[model samples]
Target: MALIILMLALQFYGVPHSSMFTFIFSGVSFEEILSRQIHLPILWVSYLIIPNFIILDAQRILSKTHLIQLRGFQYSHLQFELISLMGTLFITIIYVLFSFTWIIALMKMTHAQIFSFAGLKEMSSYFLFFLMILIGLICLVLIQATLNLFNSVLGIILPFSWIIFTSFTVWKFNPLNGLMLLRYSSYNTIQTFIFCFIIIIVLTTTFLTVVRKKDFI
Candidate 1:
């Protein structure tokens, strides 16, 4: 409920479509401005809120004795972890779908210039980029969950550490030339898929190993 309201507020006032490129010397069309503004919040939501929710949900599952009892049919920590992963995945999918749908609906209602084919292609590219970032975030959240399971303090520290490191990297090295994939890349379809697969595999493997070795109460 709070998230929904916050998203609505951001849509109205966060970044105005008309003034997006005001400082740039090169003139940008209204369509480009509208598209950029529309997608900006989508990127923000995926990058900021989703990961926090992932960690929070994982923490709830681990900390709540009743939830543990209900979910732990076999009294297995692996089972609990798996359940948490599945739940987090489901929530992430729903959020992605809803955000995309809402953005499309808003564009249509507002008669946004991005309704054309070119705009749609651009939007599709952005969506793909968002999904790639989301996959990485999920992996990071899983790792955090594992840390939280091991020691509550690590859970709190790791997230802040990651945020600070990422912020510094983005500040020092622009996404266009940096290691961040949040910006669109020129990789072909096969290359992109392979890259995403490798990252997901590495992160997931590490997360699983950490969780598997942890001594859960």
Candidate 2:
């Protein structure tokens, strides 16, 4: 809750008043918002940090309870992974929904023009873009957690490094590049979504397999 508020405050402060509506309604992708390309270093960093908050909290819960839950409670590895994945999904959904809701509210409050038909139509596109980003984040989180299960240091480094690396590069077919796929990539929304879906499924399956095999001491 506090972190969401902090993100709101940062957006309100870092973004110029005259450009707030443009920033909201304009073609600002969530990736750009998270990257240093925005020139608002603090805001971009804060955006990236939000996912780490989720990662750290999820890790804490899993680490603290995995042993007891598996041994004492007689939970199967598949059962435990399912519970953890469900928890992650729940938190991700809530976080993304709340973040976007507040952003939309802010846009509406500041730019009354959004109530118009055209603005509302444009808003739907943003929703789809956000959904893509949400799925990408989920994949990244799961991949990170899976790595962390094996080695803590590598877990944080690889996933985050990819995010930072992608932010700096401009790849047209980058499935993770939500708006870029529409703007520059040959792949359309459906194609990008298919790729993302595949990635998520692969990552989830791999994570579960690892959990089953890993001797969590």
Mark the regions of model 1 whose C-alpha exceeds 4 Å error after superposition. 1-47, 60-64, 67-72, 115-127, 156-160, 170-182, 187-196, 214-217
In terms of TM-score, how similar is model 1 to the real structure? 0.59
The estimated TM-scores of all candidates read 0.59, 0.70
Q: What is the lDDT of residue 16 in candidate 2?
A: 38
Q: Report the C-alpha displacement of residue 192, candidate 1, in angstroms.
A: 7.2
Model 2 misplaced regions, further than 4 Å? 1-45, 64-66, 112-121, 179-188, 215-217
Question: How do the residues 80-126 of candidate 1 rate in per-residue lDDT, one tens digit apiece?
Answer: 66777777667766765665565555444444433233222466655
Candidate 2 residue pairs in backbone clash: none
